[model samples]
Target: MPVITVKLAKGRTVEQKQQFVEVVTNEAVKKLNVKEEWVTVIFDEYERENWASSGELHSLKFGEGFGMKGIEK
Candidate 1:
């Protein structure tokens, strides 16, 4: 069994996550020759404040400006 773990900043709809899982699973199945059922896609959502880059918080950097609205909601 192949286990895939994905860590992304929180704030995506269920549909989006589902799409990601499907695409990732498909790719794993095709490229890694893993069974679709055996492919595991795990998503770990985190608050914008909890995820940071370049020593700056995501919410503070992009939430206020940068068209990142609705990402925290």
Candidate 2:
């Protein structure tokens, strides 16, 4: 079995998540030789204030709307 964990800033639609899961599951099944049922995909979403990079919080660097529509940098 293959377990995949994806972590990202919050604010995505269900359709986006479903599309990602489908693509990831297909790749896992093909590359890892795992059954579709045995492949697990997990998403861990966080707020901009809770995530940071380069010793700076994303909220401070990009405001509270980072990763939202029209604000992905």
Candidate 3:
């Protein structure tokens, strides 16, 4: 089985996650030669405060409620 773990800031709709998983699973099947059922996709969500870059927390840099919708730079 192929296990894929994706870590990101939290707050996304279920539909978005589903679509992402579907696409990732399909790609894994094609690229890794793995069966769809054998490909595992795991989403690891974190709070903005829990993620940081360049010595600043995402929550501090982007302010609160950041990444509460979609991907943010």
Candidate with maximal lDDT: 2
Q: Please give the RMSD of candidate 2 to the true structure.
A: 2.0
TM-score of 3: 0.86
lDDT of 1 by residue, 1-73 (tens): 7988888776678998899889989999999998899998787777777777899897776773322574556
Q: Give the alpha carbon lDDT tens digit for every residue of 1-73 in model 2.
A: 6888999988888999999999999988898788999988888998888988899888888877535533566
State the displacement of the C-alpha of residue 27, model 3, in Å, after optimal TM-score superposition: 0.6
User: Which residue ranges in model 3 land beyond 4 Å of their true spot?
Assistant: 68-73
Where does candidate 3 have its weakest 10-residue lDDT segment? 64-73
Q: Candidate 3's residue-wise lDDT over 6-31, tens digit each?
A: 89877777998999999999999998
Best by TM-score: 2
Candidate 2: residue pairs that collide: none
Each model's C-alpha lDDT? 0.78, 0.84, 0.83
* Runs of candidate 1 exceeding 4 Å displacement: 64-73
